[model samples]
Target chain A: EAGVTQFPSHSVIEKGQTVTLRCDPISGHDNLYWYRRVMGKEIKFLLHFVKESKQDESGMPNNRFLAERTGGTYSTLKVQPAELEDSGVYFCASSQVGAPDTQYFGPGTRLTVL
Target chain B: SQQGEEDPQALSIQEGENATMNCSYKTSINNLQWYRQNSGRGLVHLILIRSNEREKHSGRLRVTLDTSKKSSSLLITASRAADTASYFCAAPALSNTGKLIFGQGTTLQVKP
Candidate 1:
């Protein structure tokens, strides 16, 4: 089966500019997630989507970041007026619904905000 | 915030030697997973040990969990250059486990 896939493998933008990163989960997978890793830091959870509904978004950083899973098929994370600290790798993952399953990740999008 | 922490930030070993990495976490969890990532790539799930389990093995990978200590260890035996990667441990929060918080990761280098 094809694994999770992400677009624009790398993105470079300026501070105060906007950037959108996309993620396409494995087919038929209802659970999708977004995570990020800043320089010299651990990867962190951002949000979770089950089908067309958001399961949780507690990890989302601030008001400038918005993630949407339209039709629960694919996901997009948009950073408006990005900040310098927003420069990092954005990762997307998917898994079978419920617990006790493993999540597969895609090649992350490396975002550089100058 | 990241709940899991990997020890020894980095490690190096010969191809024939074994490499072990440890992870510790705070708070309760249902399961803990391990993942590997090359220098410029996404994470690949290595193994998962449930809260009730003590040990699991797949190929050359062995993972052990100790609830009392809230820690886990991953051992890769007879390593190869392909094993050179950053290893991370993840523990999903009890409420929304689909979102996994990861450790800082142990960077392992297996030299031939």
Candidate 2:
């Protein structure tokens, strides 16, 4: 089976512009999650989705950051009016229902906001 | 805030040498996990040790968790150049919400 995949391996956007990152989880997986890693910083959790429902979003940085998983098979994270601090590698992970911790990660989307 | 902190921010060892890195966390955790990230790549899950378990091994990798001290260590035996990468330890928040807080990470370099 194919591993998790992300779109636009790298993105460069203006500070005030809006950017949307996409993630397609592995087939037959029910749990999907988002995480970010700023330069010289640890990877931080952003949010998590259980199928079509968001299980946890307390880690989301702010209102400007919106994540959606309409059909549950895929997810989209949009950062509106991006700021310089938003520049970082955004990672997507997935896991089966039985084992929630053995998450498989996707090659992150490196977002650079100028 | 980051949940764990890895010691010896960086390490360099010759191939065939054993490489060990330690991680210390503050809160109670349901389980602790180790992950490896190659440059420009995603984080790959290495091993997971439940709070009650003290030691676990997979192939050449050995992981030990000491809940009493709230610390864990990862040891890669007979390391190879391919073992060079950044290692991170992560744990779910105190709430156990399926989200993980990662450590600062230890960058390991195994020179051939």
Candidate 3:
């Protein structure tokens, strides 16, 4: 089975620009999660989705960040008016509903906001 | 606030030697998981030890969990250059939720 996959392995944009990162989870997996790691900081959870509905979003940093999972297939995270501090690696992970603890991660998208 | 914290921010060892990394968490958890990440790469799940289990092994990897102490350790025996990576320990933020709280990670470099 294919593991989680993300798009645009790297992205460069200016501050105040909008960027969207996409993630396609493994086939038949119902759980999808988003995490971000800023330089010199630990990886932090952003949000989680079970099917098309969000399971938890308490980790979302602010109102400018938005995440959606449509049709319970793929997920997209949008950062509007990106700031310099938003530059970091964004990782997408997936796991089976029955086994949510062992997540498989994607290659991650490196976003640089200048 | 991160739930887990790994000790020894970095380590260097020669191949064929043993590498041990420790992690401690603040809250209760059903299980603890270890993951490895090569530079600029995503994380790869290594092992998971439940609260009730004291030890588990997979090939050259050995994981021990002490629920009473809220600590865990990962041991890689006869390490190879390929084992060089950043190791992270994660636990669920809540026993019923899948949200994972991660540690700062320990960078291990194994010389051939």
Q: Give the TM-score between model 1's chain B and the true chain B.
A: 0.96
Better of 2 and 3 by DockQ: 3
Residue B109, candidate 2: Cα error in Å is: 1.7
The clash count of every prediction, one per candidate, is 0, 0, 0
Q: Report the interface RMSD that candidate 2 achieves against the true structure, in angstroms.
A: 0.9
**Candidate 2 residue spans exceeding 4 A from truth:** none
Q: Between candidates 1 and 3, name the one with more favorable lDDT.
A: 3
lDDT of 3 at A2: 85
Calculate each model's fnat, 2 decimals. Answer: 0.83, 0.80, 0.83
Model 1 stretches with alpha carbons more than 4 Å out: none
- For candidate 3, the lDDT comes to 0.93
Q: What's the residue-level lDDT of A110 in candidate 2?
A: 94
Query: Which numbered prediction scores highest in TM-score against the true structure?
Result: 3
Angstrom error at residue A111, model 1: 0.8
lDDT of 1 by residue, B21-96 (tens): 9999998888999999998899889999999999999999999999999999999999999999999999987675
Per-model DockQ against the true two-chain complex: 0.74, 0.80, 0.83
For model 3, how does the per-residue alpha-carbon lDDT over A63-82 read when each residue is reduced to its tens digit? 99999999999999999989
**Which TM-score values does chain B get in all models?**
0.96, 0.98, 0.97
How close to the true structure is residue B11 of candidate 1, measured as C-alpha lDDT?
98
Q: Report, to 2 decimal places, the DockQ of model 2.
A: 0.80
Ranking 1 against 2 by TM-score, winner: 1
